[model samples]
Target chain A: MELLDFARGPALQFALAVFVLGFLWRIVSLFLMPRTKDRSAARPGTRPALFAATREIIRRTAPDKAFGKHSLFALVNGYVFHVGLFIVIIGFAPHIVFFRDLLGVAWPSLPNNVIYAAGVITIASMMVALVRRFLNPVQRLISTLDDYFSWLVTFLPVLTGLLANSHLWVRYETLLAIHILSVELFLIWLPFGKLMHLALVFVTRSQIGTHLAHRGAQI
Target chain B: MTREINVQAAANRFLAQISGNLGAYMEACLHCGHCADACHFYAVTDDPRYTPAYKLFPMARTYKRSKPPLSWFGGAPKVTEKDLQEWEELLFDSCTMCGRCTMVCPMGIDIASIVAASRQAFVAAGLGPPDLLQAAENARDKGSPLGVSADVLADRVEWLADDNEVDIPLDKEKADVLLTVSSIELMKYPDSLVAMAKLLNHAGIDWTLSSKGYEATNFGFLSGRSDIAKIMIQRIVDAAESVGAKTVVIPECGHAYGVLRWAGANILGKPLPFEVVHITEFLADLKRRGKLKLKPMGDAVTYHDPCQISRRGGATQAARDLLDGFATDFREMTPTGNHNWCCGGGGGVQAMSRAAGLRHKVFKLKMDQVEQTGADTMLSACANCRLTMDESKEHWHWDKDLGSLVEVLAEHIDESNAAA
Candidate 1:
């Protein structure tokens, strides 16, 4: 009970603070950083640049025609874990209760069983992705220590949350505290590693989408 | 003893090029391995070194070093002279800046642009393919990268006009459109320029090739020398302004049009006075205005999109629209439009002796794509692509003929509709 209180109170607060500030700092730096300007007159596209850029946040969820079967597998498998993680984070009742505690706002949540299923799928998909990363030459070549660490931090929360929900591997209170702590670890590490892609994927993607628009094309 | 580049200056050059959300792109890459699939270099070689994102490592390191927490942690250990030396091939030979990876990235990171930045750093370190570097010098010193001087251009223009019996105007002042010819067409594929003459004549567009700045291909762009690229492009801009031309038509060269349309004003740090259009785009505009009458080309033809012209330049439909105007059987590559594969010889690969093996190997991937189309002739707008494919087509004993899109249209052009 004491561990749970510490995890929920101080650790969670500290992690959230770091996460928010770090994310903003990085994002702000990116926008504020000296970027090359296209001073040339642009050939207008089908729509405005900003609109095309914004559309890419949703547009990049699927692969284009150039991506082959193996690439398709990697992309589709990525979505499985991403969608699962989204459900577990946003739809799970306990996670929403946590959010409500933080923000003083609440939303309807999914059934516990559904959350459990999502957690399981997320963990499984993440494991497969990790395995692919280890085996795939390109991924292995480019991956850094941060990638593995980010994966660990992200995986621990899902694994611990599932264990807590199932009451299988550890005492319920201990597992619950560990899950929250793992989530806090993920939050703290998020902005420092490639996990920052959660925010930056949209930033860089929109830059291209809008860039293509300026040159008279769509994403 | 080996000469060492000033690492500090190269690093600064790398830092300067972190433009257009490059900081975010460096941050956002998931290293998912999908980018490798999109690269012809990696696809052909199966070498991890050819991975598109892998090539951006030095630039990414420089970017991270400039930022906060990563900066504090060893400052990502500044990119070394040796690293630049090593990256010369990766930045130049192995990659074409084709932008297929840019189209395919889930993060939509413009990996090609980042690679180009890396090339700039390579250039700052005096490390790049010798032919490209020499050509950049030749372009500045001589009139053309291929050494087609003003005298040479005049001689070629006169010879082609007399031989073909076509009115190839040169250095005419006060023309409406200032036509810039690629050195490739001036030297190797003169037929494309003749074809352009025929098409432009048919459309009745007031245009003249400039003796002052006739060469369109900018080797500086391939060598990553912005100074030289600006100089090369400035020559054309000066010619246009001198003539009081309303528009400039870039010949059938990919990066030539790309430099003019996209990067010209940005490189010059001012807006161009007139419009810049690719020869194909010029044709498409003529067709749209019902200026040029055409007959159907009774052959199974397919179009290859030059990387800089279509994928990066966004004049994708221009060539296709022109093809549809004449080609009775126009079969597109499986993944056509902005998603086309590169000819494997772009970005100065065709000029490098060391990269010939890899360049030839990568050409197979393009050959396979072309083979699948099964068109009797494969047509492309850029002379560089046409030449590269023509060489490879001979190597593979490809039955399909390689042709310039402009030449094909000229062959089928209805001379009755030509301007008086």
Candidate 2:
């Protein structure tokens, strides 16, 4: 088979299977872990624990006032890259075509320029983030090899996809093939590395949210 | 490595108790460094190692190795003796387990809880602070970390009653309220215990001081020994049960409220039969119910939230409501309530004599917090907080008056309506 066909077919299939199974395995392991019971007398909260957990997922998108000033760069930069990736992935017409062909469904795509702008912004934001990690003393100290590797895999697909669309790379087919391969790499890495935070962040936020809300503090 | 204890066994023991959100929190961390600034130690010292997430290294490292799939990669770093040596200070001396980092993290990792878990592993490895460990031993053996025994509490109560001319009941067979004082109150601040008596008497509540479990403070909880925490809390539980007390009013001790109200049942693997409340919460309820007629004061006052009481304990408004009830000019610290900065001396840090310099150093930030509030009197519902802040105040020679909330509130209880 041609490289493009192999990249878009067997590689995609294998990566998805690994991603799905690994993701589920990791989640199951989390559930398997014993949970600390709050056997203390509880105060009635205005909202139920479940609702509070759901609320905290959105509430923590911004930092609390005391620490907000310090988190400004992280806040804006994080949102920019994440929203940018979402737009580039699902809001672009070609990406939507790939999605519809896979899932048998598609949403409305943004204009080409908008998608291009999002792609550029995502790339820039990611680079700035990586630089921040490289430079900031705290980030530099805490970041592990997994953090840098995850960033590379995540950034490659966006960069390759944008180059393929712009036809600025070696050839359209090769660029698209490389883009698909990069996405596969990201999928394989997602369930194992810190990128697994995609699923676990909600789990963590919800768990703590419930724990605190049950005790009468608003998350 | 310590020769007497097997380090790997301690790691295994700690890994065995990985409960609740431990797995998820370990998986969710991005090492984004957001938790760094959220920590008071890092906030004050600007030290990268003092970052909250870094403190979880030992536990996180061991946890990865304990799990098969993650360890199979051969990439999970081994915990070194050298790493443990540095972490001993990082986990015990610096971080207060205040939960501010937990609150501020975008991923919702319980950074403070995980830090406490790391301390458990260290303590198991025979690496805990000697001061805190000794205090826990005293708490387990003597019924009070400060060695304030039952006879000491009874004699002190008697002396305070005669000195203040107040009705102080002790060891009643049955009472609706069981007033438990911290060792700090019994050993050092007997007047606060007197204040407790005055408030309970003014409310006409059926309250009694149990000689069996008078010390509310639990050093075992601070030292990361859940077994000792259970034993310490069980004394109070048994005392409450024997006395037939419906409510155990935890004195102005933050960690006491934590280990008793929150961790009591979890450590014991059973729910406590009676209610556990902080003195501030009980006082606030009394104020709400018009049980105590407190005369309003004009002095400018603010409250220092003990980490365990306000943020981790979730009784954010109890002290504020009590203060607002009686103070006409009650000022607030920036980021008050659950978001308030931890007084530098919590989480057994105050008990560890070696941590005094760092404790006093970071206390400058807390002093700045109080000074900015422009308050003459800063009251704390947690004696652990008041004790440390008072010491730090002496170090800095800070001019403001620091008082326990219940003690200050005692002065405001209207004498005309007080029960004879």
Candidate 3:
């Protein structure tokens, strides 16, 4: 019944190993790939400037104006999914409660109602994204089986969490365990899938910023 | 006088040709909107409708829902019914396919390719920009964008040659470099041809322009039909092989550079045995080796990044190093390098008469940046950018010398006939 028991369990340990190893493998592969030769001898530095470049990147990538007509749906829904998902990951009561008991310190947890709302929004946004992909021929052609699977993996945890909250069909503890397991699976998949953009986003943004800055770009 | 358009057949063929590579990229768009600001049309006009993402929407919707029960729901929009003509016009005429949006896309969606494919579909439906369509069809039939006669080319070649020295070969057999030029250079900008010839002559570079494949413009690029593009490039490749050219210098048009540099390997069945360099790259190589020297303009100078040269073509910096020779106060626009704004004349927009107002409006982004720098002169590597910037200066009355990098560099060539 103790929170530390779940943290120290075999499932968590196994998933952590897979996640760490998988994450390293992907990053190394990207690093090792053949880069386009610099035909012009304007040296883009050897040591990657991750922080400085990312700041410039975020500034450029910032939307100057709202996205075009009827585009608010995609933009607003995407933000909700991303922000709400972030809250549930870091602010879930169970996660904080367990951290408090095991690590002797914890961050604040969202109210149970807030967590439920986050879970609902995550599901809603994901469904919209999936529908957009499915109904759009251009999107569908570019989509792969892995993309659909990522959506499933992404949405399932939120769905299961909401189901656990409802406590309608299954026992609360059983559904709660499934939700944790799904979260664990998703975390392990993060660094491998398109989700890795979460970490590489800054890398690309910074690279663009620094390269432009070197070229004397004021923007 | 008139032929009926086969809208459905054209659409199907275009879809089939692009479905594999383009479909792969289209599926990746999470619609993050990162690329919206990067687009020249969107940046200048602040028109959400002009965003690269919106241009691909009709195609994306149809692509996603074309199967089974989804097809029953009418998932994709087609160019067959009423208002389909309007959608075709929007997709084909509105977008320039500059590829700046592709560089900024988080998913690396290659938005230019998507726009190009959509344009190809539009062209299939006979819905391409009237001017662009005329040019493509003309190039398809006449072998040059201006519909220039062989006699005019001969006269221009003769004008570029010095009477006392070596004759510029008309159809020389087996040269080291096959120099191809943009249609503009052939017709309007004789100065570029003269500059290229002078550079070639000064360096003692063994090169010949193909009378057969003299053209550098490929309309398949504008029409979005890869097959047409392939056929157009095949002419250049065949001509290069005929002369056993070890290198090909595609003169400074962004799309021309892109076609020669990127499409060469694909259309030629391998990496071009002959090296393919943009004229800018050729000049940069000469500059780096100290073979070419320039008298610095010693004035405030700014450079505009052409989309094909910078992003698709990757020859922007090479052009800049050459420009550094003359610029006293060299300022760059906010988002330069691969992330720079487009000239808006790309993707046949310059020739697309209907898109002229839009092109001029979109070009203001670069124009404003140049003006803010207080630069009296601007240098661009791509011929299209040079043409567009010149038009911008004329239309907007922005007092600046919009010169091609080659023309500028030729003025600074330190070596003389006696010295060499």
Candidate 4:
């Protein structure tokens, strides 16, 4: 089969299967692991523990005042990249068509210019994150090979998608094929690397809130 | 590697101690390094190793190696002796397990809890700090970490009872409150005990000090030994039950209150038959009930909320209410309440002599916070915080009066109702 056909057929299928099954396995393992029961007395007259957990999952998305100043770069760049990626993935016209084809659901797409702008911002923010990881000594110290590898995989999909959309330096079909392949690579890597954070973030944040609220401290 | 290290055993111990949420925390960390800014040690020393996330690296490494998808790839780097040696200082001496990092983590990772799980592995591997281990042993065998015998505690109680002209009941059966104190309160800050005695007496509360469980500080909890912590907690439970007390009042030691108030149920494997309260909370409850009255202290004072008492024990409002009732000029420190920085002496770091320098170094953040409050006298309910602040005061020759909240309340007690 031609590279484009293989990329769209087998590569896409394999990536989706791995993505779905890998996430299921990881999530199931998390639930299967023994949970330490919190035997501490619940605070009286307080909201239920799950309420605090849900509250934190929402509350932590914004920069907390306690560490806002220190986390400005991380908060800004992180939000920009994540929101941009979300728009590019779900709001772009072609991606919406692709999703509709796959899942039989249709949604209104944003303007091409808006999606393009989001792609550009996402690419720029990923670059900033990359540079910060290399430049900041503490960040560099904590970073592992997997961190850099994940960054590369995460960054390439947006970069290639934007390039494909722009039809720059390559045929549109070829660029599109490369973009899909890059996205497939990212999907394959998602469950194994730090990108697993996409799912675990909700789980951990609520867990932290539940534990803290059980002790009667609002997170 | 000539040294034989049971990395697998240590890994199992760590996994056993942690929960599923911990797995999520490990997986969710982005290595954003925001937690570094939250740690006082890293803030003061500018050491990357002291970063909260860095402190969790060893456990994260082990988790990745032993657990699923990553484990298929030869796992993470093995837990080596060098890692253990390095992490011993990072986990115990530098980090106070203050939970500040946990609060500030954008990913909502409980960094302190992860460090605590690491400490459990260290303890299981016989790698816990010697001083903390020794203190835990002392508390296990001698009933007091400071080695103050029961007779010594009884004598101090007698002396305080005679000095205050009130009967300090010891092991009194069927009391309303079973008041337990730390060794620091009994030894270094006897005046706090005196203050508590006066207030309890003046309020006409049926409270008694138990000789069997007088020491509230649990070195096992500090040392990360569940067995030792359980033993220490069970002693207090037994003492409280034997006295048939409705409430067990933990004195002004921060971790002491945390051990009994929070961890007591877990250690005892059931709900405590009696209520556990901090001295500040008890006093505040009395005032709220109009059972105890206090004259207003006109001095400008700021209250330091000990991390454990306010953040962990949920007694922040109680302390504030009590302080507001008595101190007409009560000033709040910036970033007060649950977000207050630790006094750099908790988690048994105060007992470890080797950690003194690091503790004092990290104490600069707290010192600056207190200085900004501009209150000459800073009152704290935790005896450990008070002692650490006093040490910092002497080290820097800081011209500030560090007083206990209970003691200050005792000095301003309203004696008009004594005649009744």
The local distance difference test score of each candidate is 0.84, 0.85, 0.67, 0.85
Candidate 3 docking classification: incorrect
Per-residue lDDT of model 3, residues A1-219, tens digit only: 544347348667777787777767645644454433223222234234454465566664544332334344655666678898888777888778867875799987888888888888788888988897787443554454446767788887888878988896788777777877886788676655556666555444554444433323323
Error of 3 at B417 (Å): 9.7
Model 3 misplacement above 4 A: A1-219, B1-7, B18-20, B67-80, B162-168, B225-227, B268-271, B416-420
Query: What tens-digit string does per-residue lDDT give for candidate 4 at A82-186?
Result: 999999999999888989998999999999999999999998899999998888878989999889999999999998988888889799889988999999999
Writing each residue's lDDT as its tens digit, candidate 3 over B1-420 gives: 243465665557545644333544544455555466667776676665666776776666556554322244354556454444656655666666776665556544557666766776666665665667777766777777788555667777887666424456667888998998887976778778778877777776788888778788787677665666766777887888899998888887888877666655555455555677778888778777766656666766777777777766556678777777566568776666666677878778778776778878877877777777777777777777778767876888776778777877676666643124
Clashes of each: 0, 3, 18, 1
Q: Arrange candidates by DockQ, highest first: which order? A: 2, 4, 1, 3
lDDT of 2 by residue, B1-420 (tens): 343444785687678768747878877788888888778888888899998888888778888877755676764788877778778899999988888888778888888777777788888887888889999998888888888878877788888899999999999889998988888877777788889889888888899988777778888878988788878888888889998988999988888888788878888889998899988899888888888788898999888888888888888889888877588999998878888888888899989898888888888888888889999989888778888888989998989999888888899889787644
Ranking by TM-score: 2, 4, 1, 3
TM-score, predicted candidate 4 vs. hidden true structure: 0.97
Candidate 1 residues lying further than 4 Å off, grouped into runs, are A44-46, B1-3, B75-78
Selected candidate, larger lDDT, 3 vs 4: 4
lDDT: worst 10-residue window of model 3 chain B: B66-75
Summarize candidate 1's per-residue lDDT along B1-420 as a digit string, tens digits: 365677777778988777547777877888887888889898887898898988988778778888786675554656777777777778898988888887678889988778777788878876778788898899989988889999998899899999998998898977999999888888899988899898898888888988877878888877889999889888998999888898899988888877788888988989988898889888998988888788888888788889888888889989988877488888998677788888898877776767877777877877777789888778899998887777777777777788888898898887766545
Interface RMSD of each: 1.5, 1.5, 8.5, 1.6
Better of 2 and 3 by DockQ: 2
